[model samples]
Target chain A: MDSMLSTPRAPRIAEQAAQWLEVLQRGGAEERKAFAVWLTESRRHVEEFLFMTAVDRVLEDVDPQQRIDVEHLLTQGAGKVVPLPAERAAAVSAGVDRVEPAGMRRRSVMALTALAAGCAAVAVAAWGLLAGTGWEDYSTVAGEQRTVELEDGSLVYINTLSQLQVRFSETGRDLRLLQGEAMFSVERDPLRPFRVDTGSAVIQAVGTRFNVQRRSRQTTVSVLEGAVRISTEAQTQEEGELVAGPQQSVPDSGMLQAGEEASIVVNGRITRRPIAEVARVEAWRERRLMFRADTLQDIAESFNRYNRSPRIRIEGEQIAARRFTGVFDANDPESLVAFLGAYADLAVDESGDELVVRMK
Target chain B: MQTESSKQTDGLAGTALEKYRKDLHRFLVRRLQHAEDAADLAQEVYLRLLRVENSEWVRKPQAYLYGVAAHVVFEYRMRTEKEPVTFDSEVMEQLAENPAGVQPDELGDRLGLERQLERLLGTLPPTHLAVLLLHKRDGLSYEEVARKLQLSVHTVQKYIFQAKARIRMEWQRQEAQ
Candidate 1:
């Protein structure tokens, strides 16, 4: 039981589940205390525990007939197919990546299927997501940044704590930004509409790139490169609903053009704005914050997005309102504090979980 | 305990349920394979949110919502615990439409994924599969499985981990596909 928790290659979620199951399987005071702490680490830890419990129950009851069928399929699949040299070369030489041993095995299988299934067996993004097959989910933990490349040649730059599911069907490419922010440099597909959905709003791309940040109240869709159609659920539900928006909301919904940005709020109101502050909006993904003629409060707000501790506070409206402009590492509060101390003749007090500033 | 740092973090992390109702439901729909179940799960999430005594330390509300949604999906699937359940139509259609054999029609792509899952499962050593099947299918606790099979709990757990790992890995591997 103890050894189960330390397995080297188990998926992190399953491994954490093993560790959690071990605690539940064995009852004790110290173990419970530690388990409580782990559970508090994130909502994820709790979900993993529940997931394991369900997976445990479900797999056991997999109908015996189905199990037999699967067993038969496994044996049959071993000698599944012999790929032609041409297909083999396409499988291995073509840019289809084999990053892991499992994928390597599947690539051979994919090669075999491509030859055998013809158009019928074309790999679809729906397969991966539906079955937990090959659909890759890219996410960042707190304060983390990651860049992921999708199978359809699309690139996703995931901002901190963001959850993005990259799903591509034969006819369409879809990215679901579950939370946080992600900038998608979508490769163009004419037949396959590339749609990025942020729950309330769908950013449809004809052939372009954009960013979607799902803040609590408003979802900001910013286009850095090309035009994107930002559609909200209500607008899509009743076209006139947005068309009746005194007139600006509907037409703009068709194309959120390059250098333009729009916010989709909870009430289904669409607010479009030119991305004049592109430098500032684009900086956090690069691990830095750029401010131009922004107030100390605004700078403080930007810094707050990146750090959980050492909060920055300006003393008064005069100090908070003073406009400052600079580029600083997103993770470093001390640098900003030092800069403030020197630039504004302020005193920087670094104590416990906060960095407070006031005029000298 | 409410400090300036906490306020700032709250702004970055707090997720009002209204903001992501559609997204949460959609996630459940994908996983649960039923819109009604997804809606029920979404409402459950909202109720859970309402019951939260302190929203502090509940950082990253969207991630948190999905976390809750994940549990809801698992729980929804598990509602039939110990009852014999066949592979989902999704799973069956996938099996029926596998590329090596027949013309899969519309279901081929999804059912075709069975090849990947089976291939991954087939790679596990027999011992690992046995332990996992016993634990999962027979509903035996690790200790019970170990005792029944005359093996150590450590051995039992190890194989279970291996099987679970393989399934999880294949699912993830497909993510990148």
Candidate 2:
């Protein structure tokens, strides 16, 4: 095998496979016909195509959190301000471009002002002081995770495909989890409460660590450290300033202590339960997914969040209902694929656009 | 155990097999080295092709047939061979690394591969790296990437193809080592 790979024909075959892959992804009917003819020309062509496919799968599986910031690298390479698109311009100036030297600090501050104006739809009057301040927006793309430290010494562990807006005013520390999941470790401040609004629910905590995951129709809150009071009513602007007061127990409000979890539905229904193991729920911070007899459907959904290609698709209801218990690296779907391949009752079809699982 | 419903579901694959059975058998006989295994390998390839959700999407049936045949042959060698294949040494190393003899977790291997790709990407020219990342990471089209980078669409495609070729070569070099 080593001898075969060392031959000059190997690199040529690899280059042909790469070109074929590109054509298959972006080309029209004529190009595909050409590819099919090329694929059938030799056995070496077939082997190289499979090998390149594996390499492309590995590229797709790379953890988005570890991806190098392309725009930042390009800017550094150019050593001059390159014109950025509008939405990206805001993120660049507010987040990554802040690390520039003193010479570019003034320009970044000006960019921050522009960002503040752009966010005026959601920002209040107090947010006008965002220029050169701690107010900012943080987000992680698909399969990406990040931990950010706020000005008040609080930590936010943002999960994949999440968006968060932080507005730290003199009166209160307000955070809005616009989408996806995030864990907030709040700093103790009796005067200002840390509140996270998930569109459907508003959770208020004081000097505690809690996780809030905003799904399509429901927001799930799991308290790991201290008690958090959740209000399922419509969010008011002044809600962020309400600290630990005597009226904490409102009619539409419920308190979840450590080792407790709650699902607040869209229509203001809160179902609270005791968490068997809080650590399992928080395992995502360590990039591990721990499942206990989870259905194949749910497992596939979780894995799909991190992988872009060869998506796991359960074809039959019986196969989808099968129970799987294991600990898998969140970014590695090959492990799951191997497990499925070993199961006697299941058949995995990996030839199509998705990895389809069916009952044998 | 083949029921009436199973037969109906296998209609498209049965047609494909009828058309390409001779070609697949001949190809397998050459690759398997054991001519006796050729017939069984063709049957395995047929079964796999039957599993495809939609055979109609396969524009070129003969090429698709050979593709499935190649996959079956590869798996046959993997199952029958005693000595570990050197090309898959990375996976073999992963299996051997676990002290508890548990199933090999792909996390460590994936991380190592990611780092290797990162280093290889760093060595690429700026234009090649940018074009590759913009298309792959940012999900931009070839036209959009060309527009953003002020390069022609054909150049963008060439850069991407070359970048992947370089990565493939790097992986081969490591495996050779």
B1-177 in candidate 1: lDDT tens per residue?
011110111221222222222223333213322323333554565555445555431433333444455445444555647544443535323322331221111223323334444555666665566556545433344654555456766766667766765665454444435
List pairs with backbone clashes in candidate 2: none
Ten-residue stretch with the least lDDT total in model 2 chain A: A100-109
Assess each model's interface with DockQ, reporting 2 decimals per model.
Answer: 0.06, 0.08
Candidate 1 lDDT at A289 equals 78
lDDT of 2 by residue, A1-360 (tens): 234423434467777777765555435457656665665565456555655555555554332332355555566553333445664666565674543322132232233334334433433453346433554789997689888867655789998888998877754677888888999877654334578888777898765678999988889999875567788664644644333331244577887776789998988899999987766778888778888999999899888877776688989888788888999998888789888889887888886668888888
Residue B81 Cα positional deviation in candidate 2, in Å, after optimal superposition = 40
Which residue ranges in model 1 land beyond 4 Å of their true spot? A1-137, A234-252, A277-281, A314-322, A343-345, B1-177
For B9-89, candidate 2 gives per-residue lDDT tens digits of 133443333323322333332332222243355445545555656534256534465446544554566667865544453
Q: Which TM-score value belongs to model 2?
A: 0.42
Off by over 4 Å in 2: A1-135, A234-249, B1-177
